[model samples]
Target: MQTSDFLAELSQLTMGFTPVVDPIYGAEVYRFLDLSTSNTIIDSVDTSSAEAIAVYIDTYLSKTGGKVAYGGYLEKRSIYDRSLYFGTQEIQLKRNIHLGIDIWCPSGTAVLAPVKGRVHSFKDNKNHGDYGPCIVLEHTIKGDSFYTLYGHLSRASISELEIGQEFNAGETIAYLGEPEENGDYAPHLHFQIIKDLQQNEGDYPGVSSLGNLSFYKENCPDPDILLKIESKVKG
Candidate 1:
């Protein structure tokens, strides 16, 4: 497939990778994790249970000696099978392809803004398998405007956020929510960059079906363009 102009834009948009999660786990202790269906290791995981998956992630992080385990852009995952919120059992229509990069760490970990931006919207999406409390920030750097989404956030993250609330680079905007409140999944940050939100507010499609992957792939380019997490090794 051809590359997206937006994808190219995202690649060359900034000078270097910026840390959205705590810089405490920045380049040094960051590790790339594979949660896709192709990774046989995940097959042994109990993806349906948030606690079970947490154990799996914790074990991986401990063994890898990494503070953060992050990946899953456009990854075809089987974890969504337990939730009807994604779709029925039909393979082609199932929204199992993750469209964002997830940063797994302990609950209450701080989520930061990689760049200056104002709040676009914030909401509590309380579905069985949803983003839970989420925030979308509108960013304008180098005269280019787009939005960055922070999902699976703590409830307090959105309790006082205004539509135009501002956040600077590295400012604490939210915290990772617990599984009880974060769509029943392990505490993690779902970060995505979007060129267009399609009129969405705080919530957006972080997963896509096989039939609609093309459109989502263009609209939601790999966040790795800004993160460069895959290129870094644990120090």
Candidate 2:
């Protein structure tokens, strides 16, 4: 389907789930990660110390029981030079190369269906800075297949969700995984749009370095089109 048509259908689907309720924790105490400043590459971790990284992950898990939703690694890379990784150097780095939009919220937050579709696949990525519990949905609009990925979710999110199970837009399908279940970081949801997955299932890289900019741009379109309130949500 055309990008416009796909976006329109996605908008309709998301409208049904407006004012997404917090999945793991209640809204009042939890703070939504600011998306405006989010344009910058998130160097939240101390890359120098593996032990420190492990401790950070442990702290997130301890607080939310591994239920944080949108906690994972995000990168910014240059489109022109694939080898030149953005956000790596202290100088000449711009955070414009955001690969995916993230929804940072508390763990255990109930993650609802953004659109009506079937459970395409899921997996437990055990790496320290990866999507610990992730789910992907296959959607068909006008006979063309597209996919949406929800990364860094609670393990329980997919424990009972079976492949091919039909989910209605706005229906509560899973809960936000805590940092332990999610890759260690503040709880949040990594929402991504993939035009072509290249046959990959269960897991896909959400962040691409400057070297793979062209490929990611074509493969993963802008998710903001579907997330109508990008401005409000980010603000």
Worst 10 residues of 1 by lDDT: 1-10
Give a tens-digit lDDT track for model 1, residues 1-235.
2345556656665556578887887677777889888899888888889999999988888998888888899999999988989976787788999999999998899999877789999899999989999999997645767889999999988888899989987899999999999999999999998888899998999999999999998888889787766655532
Q: Which residue pairs in candidate 1 have backbone atoms (N, alpha carbon, C) closer than 3 angstroms, thus clashing?
A: none
Estimate every model's Cα lDDT from 0 to 1. 0.87, 0.60
Q: Which 10-residue window of candidate 2 scores lowest in summed lDDT?
A: 77-86
Q: How high is each candidate's TM-score?
A: 0.93, 0.67
lDDT of 2 by residue, 1-235 (tens): 6666666765665542143335343322232232222334325545334345345545644665532322122344232122222245333333334566666555777777666779888888876657778888888877888888888788888788789988887777777777666866446677787877778777877776556667777677766556544444344
